[model samples]
Target: MSPSKPTSRQFEMQLEIAAPRGAVWSAISSDTELRRWFAPDAKVVPRVGGEILWRWGDLHAWPQVIEIWEPGSRLRTRYDSSIVDGEGGKLPLFLDFFLEGEGGRTTLRLVHSGFGPEATFDEEYDGISRGWPVELRSLRLYLERHAGLDRRLAWCTTTIDLAPAEAWERLTGEEGLAAGSALDALTEGDPFRFTTPAGDVFEGLALCCESRAFSGVATSHGDGFLRIAVEKCGGEHQVWLWLAAYGPAGPGLDELEARWSTMLERLFSASGSMSAGV
Candidate 1:
């Protein structure tokens, strides 16, 4: 029998955002605009051979150099630390962005490439494929509704003692949202607005609700975005939550963290499954 063809290492994603080309370009090019939704700390030098960086509060940093910068049209960047080979040497990666617009809407295309045949490379590629769509949804939401707004960040993660499918259901369901201190049901392309018991009101457009996760944009006080996902590993379920609230100031992080932590416990309690931190 012939050997099977090797799996392709490159991936591409397209997002049509409800904004003009200029707006979409800024969302991708400007650091100020990026921090509102994309990453907590972002910097783009706006010139070929300049820098493009994403730093998440000292947790980790991704640094790249710009290769092509065409305003409102295209961008390409190269990162030296994109992959780590088994010999501990760094491999190169490239990211290309293309934008086109008509009728007040912009289509953004992202191409992420530079993976080798190593097992480690395949794992990285899979993780990025799952993550890019969610990140693009956030970019669209920020530009369409929350442009020019600042943001405060809050994130909570927990490992639940339930299966991935079950956890996904409860998290996307109305009751599950309520457990997360959010009182709303999510519907794709529909308005999602709710107030938690803590008196925090969040409003946004529901982007996607699938078997794996639920994601949406914020329309409330600031340009906010959220995504919740469930992954199954080693006979257990892990749920992760990411929330970015737009504005110079908002709810305290301690309170928001506590609320989400409580929500996770409540979710697992309903199924009589005790959770432990991952």
Candidate 2:
């Protein structure tokens, strides 16, 4: 009997953004800005059938032709390249993007296909899985630092009253307090383990922390802020809390707020009896 021909496979990457469709469309469709995050050297022609190329030094990426372009709503493309398979054979590729807007949020979905049967889907998936987070972060930073750029993410803020020393204790000390709730414990350098009330655990990093401020970045939760200040009531200490959550507008905001508030209250209650050490 004759051997069967190899079958093609598919891959995908997706993210729900807090910003509007127009904002995301501008960032992704613009050649100059897209290069800042998506690639070191990238160029795109927005019209249908136009070509998009991205390269960095000796590493050449697959060429993609615009398949569908619906302004802020959707953009799809087909990859015209030879991706090496495990057995040293080349395979064709196809990719697509689906963008949907709901109220004040947007959902970005990416689908890549045409991975021949011999292709290593796991390898490709792993690389893209790790790379997207960094790219998304770069995207967030770009939109934020640029004054005229629209903010696509939502913000949450709260205040905690404590002394500088006490605030530090609640954040860093292990007093079985709930402050440790929202706070993930740093294991190596900034690396930390994050856990949610729903029992979902994520690996993250404490990007910055000091007597007066703290900041962290989590893969599942994005970024957060905790700042300390002298209380207006004199001699007392206070902490300002802030967090940014990505994806479409959903129940996540209220849930995050509740968890954060509970954690803060626990932290305060636990550290309340401790005397100022700073």
Candidate 3:
């Protein structure tokens, strides 16, 4: 019985945060800090070989074991199928976090490795590939701006019979989001302004933008964050919209849920007659 190691395929991401390394380290290691930005709830054991548990509602994001734990430099975790996924046939996965910089700025790099290059591995690989960028944006948001504040999440989702890119157009297009700039002209880190059909105005830097996902900060909404992604679950493409507001002074959560839930339903559901849930 040895430690699990990563296989061939892996993904990496790096971002600069305007926070001290110790603060960045704490945000990734402390359970309470993780809850503020990463997941809805979290639990962490402090030492090497300790557990790092992340939960969204009743579902586990992915339970993992700490492999390396350095104070302000690096932290690595291993994700074994047996203890975490509760399935067979997949290799163990690893998440490595590296921090660099001095003073009030730090560069954080993430490596998620150990994905088998088989067709069966697509779901896990694709999901992680799409998810981490969004999560890390939240991390930077917390450390740089909203440290120590609690977060409230407003989520809405539905499924459509369209491709991810097309769904994105509908999400950011005229009849859809009516953003300040068209999807074709948008790039990551660029400023974006959009008024949702329900009158939610988001004017923030684009955090994540791809064929399948979009996330950004809403400076107008108490610096709230909005993440829109399309995931392929089963036979249909699932549309997920998450709005994160730290502390207070943002829009009403219950009202946002209702408005965006109905917005998504009216936009994507009518064409596909999809199931709507929040």
lDDT values for all models: 0.72, 0.51, 0.78
Q: Write the per-residue lDDT of candidate 1 for residues 84-188, one digit (tens) a residue.
A: 656877888889999998879989999998876667675567667777888888787777767777766666656666666677767655555643423235467
After superposition, the stretches of candidate 2 with alpha carbons farther than 4 Å from their true spots are 1-6, 83-90, 119-126, 144-278
Q: Write the per-residue lDDT of candidate 2 for residues 60-151, one digit (tens) a residue.
A: 36467888888887777776334564576655466666778876577777776765554345555444443444455445444543413322
Q: Model 3 reaches what TM-score against the true structure?
A: 0.83
Query: Which candidate, 1 or 2, would have the higher lDDT against the true structure?
Result: 1
TM-scores of the candidates are 0.72, 0.47, 0.83
The regions of model 1 sitting more than 4 angstroms off are: 1-8, 81-88, 158-187, 190-205, 218-223, 231-238, 247-254, 261-278
Report the number of clashing residue pairs per model.
2, 2, 1
Top-TM-score candidate index = 3
lDDT (Cα) of model 1: 0.72
On TM-score, who's better, 1 or 3? 3
Candidates sorted by lDDT, descending order? 3, 1, 2
Clashing pairs in 2: 19-152, 162-237
